[model samples]
Target chain A: MADASPIETHAHVLTLAEPLPLDSGRALAPVEIAYQTYGRLNAAKDNAIIVCHALTGDQHLASPHPKTGKPGWWSRVVGPNRPIDTNRFFVICSNVIGSCMGSSGPSSMADDGAPFAMRFPVITIRDMVRAQVALIDHLGIDRLHGIVGGSMGGMQALSWAANFPERCGAVLVLASAPRQSAQNIAFHEVGRQAIMADPEWKGGDYYTADLDDPRKVGPEAGLAVARMAAHITYLSEQGLTQKFGRRLQDRDAKTFGFDADFQVESYLRYQGLAFTDRFDANSYLYITRAMDYFDLAEEHGGRLANAFAGLKTRMCLVSFDTDWLYPTSESRAVAHAVNAAGAPVSFVELSAPFGHDSFLLDVPALDRVIEGFL
Target chain B: MADASPIETHAHVLTLAEPLPLDSGRALAPVEIAYQTYGRLNAAKDNAIIVCHALTGDQHLASPHPKTGKPGWWSRVVGPNRPIDTNRFFVICSNVIGSCMGSSGPSSMADDGAPFAMRFPVITIRDMVRAQVALIDHLGIDRLHGIVGGSMGGMQALSWAANFPERCGAVLVLASAPRQSAQNIAFHEVGRQAIMADPEWKGGDYYTADLDDPRKVGPEAGLAVARMAAHITYLSEQGLTQKFGRRLQDRDAKTFGFDADFQVESYLRYQGLAFTDRFDANSYLYITRAMDYFDLAEEHGGRLANAFAGLKTRMCLVSFDTDWLYPTSESRAVAHAVNAAGAPVSFVELSAPFGHDSFLLDVPALDRVIEGFL
Candidate 1:
């Protein structure tokens, strides 16, 4: 089922010929970026749109995930006749660096022929965009028609616009902030601690044996705990109440035990466990660390407006009212900065109950907004 | 320092002669409650005020904690010249059941002289209130004074007003909800899972040997992770930003590794690690479970007002504007219920940056409100 694609999609892996320079003054070589392309590149190669994937997302934009057998995360927005309109714009979604999804990440084999694990140089959102730029260059597209994303993906889109403003005609960011907040870093810190605390983690070297071996599984418990903590941040309290409330899970009464008695608990446990199967614990640590270090304003002259200075790319920023993770205020700040920089930017705060995850959900208003922007 | 009290404080343990029944239909014999009294009871015993403590809080309200040598949690509110005015009203603070602080919790010994651990009966907010009632009965205090608390402590105060309407003259609930929201349950569940995930947890039987042994420590790592996750919920995003907005922790640059690079991360790590020193992992699980099971309206015919019907006790509710844990809306709901029940009720949402922890902080407005109500 995962092999099925609604449209003709091509997956490609490109190895960089030169070492990728990192913010930590380190360099990574043999950098392999795996990406998927949907629709045809026009004769002029001017209709290409680069789609950045968020944390935990990968290169499966309009097809079923080969591992999870689930439909592409953005199939609702990026397919043919969808908001992204693959028929009109060539779509490209890549597995970000420092991710485990067929990219150069912690789980990828290094020069030593062992998994990079903790040895993988931490990559920032800008570094992810840099890799995407390499892919775009390899495809012979000098400048993209548009660059679009949400959440961490939006961070990449913003980074692209800031770092290489002339490379894209337009930028669309949704439910993302210019920098990680203290609370955001705190939550990510908890997840990292949970993963590192597990004895099974073995200093991120648990990949020595096959993870399928029951006795030698890699920090699944810790990773699941981490995921559970994070999953809560991705949702609104009202959303959780409307979905689960105080409802019991397959029982009319409390079990008087430590089982998942409440429906919310059951849902969280399932989400946590499901996440462990798809994600690498070490990769989780590295990616979250990357996000924690992201500060676009700091990268400039201590002013966010400096990041968007003299930017010609038309920008559209969308925020969800219920997104407490990256709240509407965050987007407003960015919009204000973009405005201060004299950039052509459109911003809107749409009402959604899904919180930070509203960007990925079935938001009709978001669909209309994206269509209008693109 | 812990043994030193500003006022002569007496600690007492009351053993209930009969078994105390629980919401889970289970009962425990020899139910022991540990409590501390500040100031002297008047001739009529009508000047005694029950001051309940929140989760992770204990009986030493106006004294130093025996374990950490820290000042009493609510010392500002319960001291001789404080808002609670210990000189005017005898203040009593008790260790709630299911807590590790000298209470009959998961860490307490059973009839067989073994730690109850997972065998401890799953209790509720109502059960905690029930135990408090027994303690009050033993103290020869009946139908007198007032009941006041904050956070989970506030839950006990509300439970008192509902279950024992005539037990107190007035009820003051601060920063709490009548029922645990789904988001609340989800966070608690994450903490529980983190504790259970530790290999050292050993199915809550890690107390087989001396926990002080460096080679054989009890689930401290898991408990710390759990604490880290929970500590975030107790704070507001604005408060975090104001206190530690991406400030480097005693460093000029990030190490680009899994270390506490930010001041907030350092603070959280210190908090999480320090918590494990005094808290029992299994006790943490049971207490949180109790909180998750709290639902006053569900217990009273599915209407919050039903719980307060025919109540004669005066009610004063306080909520912090930034407290997302039990937001102002929750207190508003309780206030509306009290109003519908034709009870005298006063509700106020104070502007505080501390979030849920505002109840325990030095809020001048809260001090004034408490003084005026008393």
Candidate 2:
């Protein structure tokens, strides 16, 4: 999964001419947004569909990743004849600001020529959407046909609808929540604590000139641990049971030691280690913090419906039955809020064992729902 | 929770004359078992009831903690007139091997007078029960009363019932499984990685002469992170939502940096840090590994029912509805296995929002169930 070749695409980076204001009451100068575009914008520029990536996702929506060579996280959902069909609609996915991908993040060089690291201003879901809006404005597109996202990407779509309701006509939110729950925040905190606990983290400034040696390239161990913890939440318990179920890893019996005795442990270790190679630890902390701070209802007079008051955008929310991370109840709550707001909304809870990741996995029902919504 | 005076109890340590055999094919020499006994032993000693503690628990039982002044973890259900009724039964709670309490564990001294640490042999649930059995032998108790436990303690109880069915008449297991699930092992692996990642851990030899300064004591940061991760799994998502929700941690708004902005984060941070003061990192690793290696059915021909085949001990199992850790299904599965073995068994799924910790929490229904079962 980590050693895929990069597929070429029309990836571009747009530098903001002015400083970008932040929710933290700070402004970031020289903000840059990296994005990839699939298909062509119509003559009227109204067939554009903005696809937001989830946490750890990048701009390679329909192409292979530049580093891992693996297919884009949502490659199955957005392709030539797929649900978001590049043949009919223009698809645009941009790397969020607080990410390690080719965007303005902790790993990016600052005004002083050093990596921003912890110096980078903490960003929010709305800030990410704002950056995408800048990219849209630069493309000379006044309005988009739709905005689609899953997980953190879904958060961006919801933020866009709440903050810039007129910029897009429709939105499809998949396996996401309107706000982060207390348990979700606790999980994010564990990841952050894991990352920060590593001595190699060096207070989030582990990037060095001696990059030739991979061992010296940041807190890989801590980042891997964080990834392993987070990965468990992405997949359902039933899914793990079906996939690994105390099965011995390449052995007939238990090792009776600290080594990975179960197949699940071996798989988690691999996933954790592989993640550190393509992602930055600081970016993980910042992105998770942003996600944890997301509370649409709290930001809008303590009523979730108020966030969608007088909204006109068409909304389609989809959730998987097995996703404990952002369970179907979360999506149902958002749908009820949208319904209360008198918005044209559709909600469906699809049966899938993959949990929060079912939106990206081979769930045929999700494809039909996205295609119907788009 | 970390600062409380000790309420003295008759805590005793029994050193085994012979080496104790382990599941890992290694034998531990000079093994010492620390235990606390409550109530009086009748002349026949048939009223003796052994109570096993869970993963992070000690032998405090119905007494106040020595490290923290807080009441014993199960003080709510193990007092004089409480369920398990000390007035009627001689209750014994022993610190399990591989635990950091007064027992022989990673923190215990080796033959060379240094802390065992990583040099300590890996142990298992059955190994722990074997140690407890040694202590029971020293006390001259044979074929006496019953065994009761919750979580890891419950595993010990099951192990005792299986390995020495003739020694005990009954066993009460609460919120535990016949084996550690794949998801549970994955969680334990994350915690181990977090601990091993800390530079201060110094490969498990962090013990220094300067014990005066707690900062240089050990890998407190890493251990805390591990505790934080495990703490999240102890409670139900609904329990967390009800306890903390999206509430801010003594602040009106998020700091937008890496601080604990949410109440849950703050609570978890406190829990993680507080744990470091009372627990050993290496002990945590060993205990969790022991738990991950637990599979009752695998020990007996890959059939759960075979684990209890021809068992004569009366068994009662209790599970909490909201406990995703070891949910009601786990208890049901164990009960099924016991029933299939033609043993006397009873199972109940109690309604409790505290999750896996319902056994330890103030659940009135749980109290009634325990009282009736005993």
Candidate 3:
């Protein structure tokens, strides 16, 4: 694998304390955002692309992570000669406001120098995008060439096109929908409950006593169960059967005991444990809440078409054949709304063995589509 | 729901103290099986149809559960006018050897008068079938007209045809596989680990503690998590989305905190909690072990075709389009093996939004297929 590009130091932090009134008659304030950018802006500043990250992803889109020895989540699609081609376009990725990675979240120090925990204002997808817009103004960007993202990132991309149509020239959404499905929310809630049910969770305030409370609150077992459940959703049954069909874990005969007797079991355990290392349990709570609160058309009255009223941005929507999480029907709904708004749009369902995670995996077709669009 | 049919008094028990030599050279014994029959067996015994239950299901397939207020699991399919019409078929549903519902399991008393707990020998799918075969002999039945089941029950149905082709005339396997997939074993292991990790489990010996040891050993929270995880696999994403599309749990707005805010969460919790009342944690361990050990093709020299060698039984296999647990490919594999054996067989992938549980759900197409075949 290629080494990640070095982190740029020119990024800035912005804080806002003014309460932003919401459609639900609620107000959120005291938001702090950290953002980073790469490449140079053209005279017209139209080459800017904002990359949104998924549930646990951060702003390190094209750089090596500060703690983990891994490259940025989107390095494959954003580097030189890559789909987004960072050498030719300015790329900006921000740590989402409700995330734990150097952004305002439950883990961040509060007004009294204590961790915020559950004290942070509840945020939505629009709220995260709203903060991104503020960051865009801080960076002096007027128009974006495109806003691109998958999963939660895709939620942000859709939010930008709907909430701030004039700021983006194009939109690309992958493996996401207008809102979290009931099943999706249900799985997330299970994970959250697992964390909270842990005795160490201490009502989400373990950061004060220097307690290993997050470990407990995060419900490692519950989270592991949750991750295992979610992981199944990310793969096609065909993929799973092909990859690990009746394959025993480190044994030729069944141990008939409660050991990890299958490769799939080992894989799921690794995923759950690895996830806990970088992700804040509280961030999971907040981000899933934001996704649950998302309903683009609902914000613009009940008419979905009205959400994209007069939008001019070209939109490329991609759905995977096996991605039951956000099935093809959802993409069709978005395409319908975009069409009603007379916006330039393209949609395709790509054949992939992987399910919802296909967008993040190596899919040459996805690369080709993105490259062609760019 | 209609009341469960009264269980007939032809209950029989089978015990094997010596370890029964398995095809793998491994031995499993001290197996005691409990089973009950309903309806009258014809003189020819051709009216007998064994009903296999899914994971956590018991011999009370068409009878009122003695402990819980719930009716038999297959009540809908085994009633007077149902597909496997009890009025015509002498139904036999056994509590598989590894289960705890009136069966000799970890909860059964040993000669020492203490709960066997973890002392129960590890059982396999074939072992369960063998025990059932013993029961069939005790009842003086030379052959069965058919074996019908869904999920793990379906596994037993397939096992009957593969292991005792001469003893069965037709096999109706639904929503089951020839062997448990690696993913299936992995999920089971997670559940097992959850139970074992509970401090109160006391190494599965909680039954004799004179306290609510079952509650702890049952790992209610962990089991709930496990059930929630497994429940996701039981339904198609389309079904879940249609049933509970990101709707809040009794509220119109997101709680923005870590709580069961979604209806899906509430539903999953109900599923998990209700499961504990009727199921044993140790039984969960044993049955999952049996499922993981089930690879008929592996037992017959790694050739699936060999497992069905010279099979004389006709087979009717039904798979749901959304049943990811045992996808259509699995059924195809079984059908292919049966065809290789030159046995009459038919396969159909039924259309249903419900996932693996479609076999149990009221799908008209499934009814038509069963009615036509029977």
In model 1, what is the error at residue B53, expressed in angstroms?
1.1
Q: How well does each candidate superpose onto the true structure, as a TM-score?
A: 0.97, 0.96, 0.91
Better of 1 and 2 by lDDT: 1
What DockQ does predicted model 1 obtain? 0.89
Clashing residue pairs for model 3: A182-B246, A195-A217
Task: Report the lDDT tens digits of candidate 2 across residue range A1-374.
Answer: 11222333588999999989988899887799999998888899999999999998899888889989997887777767778777778889999998978889998888998888899999999999889999999998998999999999999999988888889779899999999999999999999988888878899889885544566478888889889999999999999999999899999988767788789989999999999889999999999999998999987899999999867989999999999999999999999999999999999999999988898899888888888888
| Highest TM-score model number | 1
lDDT tens digits, residue span B1-374, model 3: 23445545356566755545554454555557777777788878789988888888888776677778677776676766577776678888889877887777777776676777887777778877877787788778898988888888888888888889889878898888888876677667666765664444668876755533444344566556667667877887779878886677778766665566778888888898888776777778788878888888887888888888858878988999988778898899999988988889999999999988898788888888886777
What's the candidate order when arranged by decreasing lDDT?
Answer: 1, 2, 3
Model 2 / residue B344 / CA error / Å: 1.1
The most accurate candidate by lDDT is 1
- Indicate the residue-level lDDT of A92 in model 1: 92
lDDT tens digits, residues B1-374, model 1? Answer: 01223676889888899889988999976688999998889989999899888888899898889989998888877867777777789888889998888879987888997878788999998899899998889989986599999999999999999989989788999999999999999999999999999988989987864434655357999999999999999999999999999999999988988888999999999999999888889988988988898899998999999999868979999999999999999999999999999999999999999999999897999999999998
Which portions of model 2 show Cα errors greater than 4 Å? A1-8, A209-216, B1-9, B209-216
- As for lDDT, the candidate ahead, 2 or 3, is 2
User: Model 1: per-residue lDDT, tens digit, A1-374?
Assistant: 02223686999999999988888888887799999999999999999999999889999988989989998998888877788887789999999999988889998888988888888997888888888988999999999999999999999999998999989878999999999999999999999999999999999988964534655368999999999999999999989999999999999898978999999999999999999878999989999998999999999989999999958979999999999999988889999999999999999999999989999998999999988888
Per-candidate Cα lDDT values, in order, are 0.90, 0.88, 0.77
Ranking by TM-score: 1, 2, 3
Estimate, for each residue in B237-327, the C-alpha lDDT of model 2 and write its tens digit. Answer: 9999999998888888888888887889899999998999899899999999999989999888889898887679799999999999998
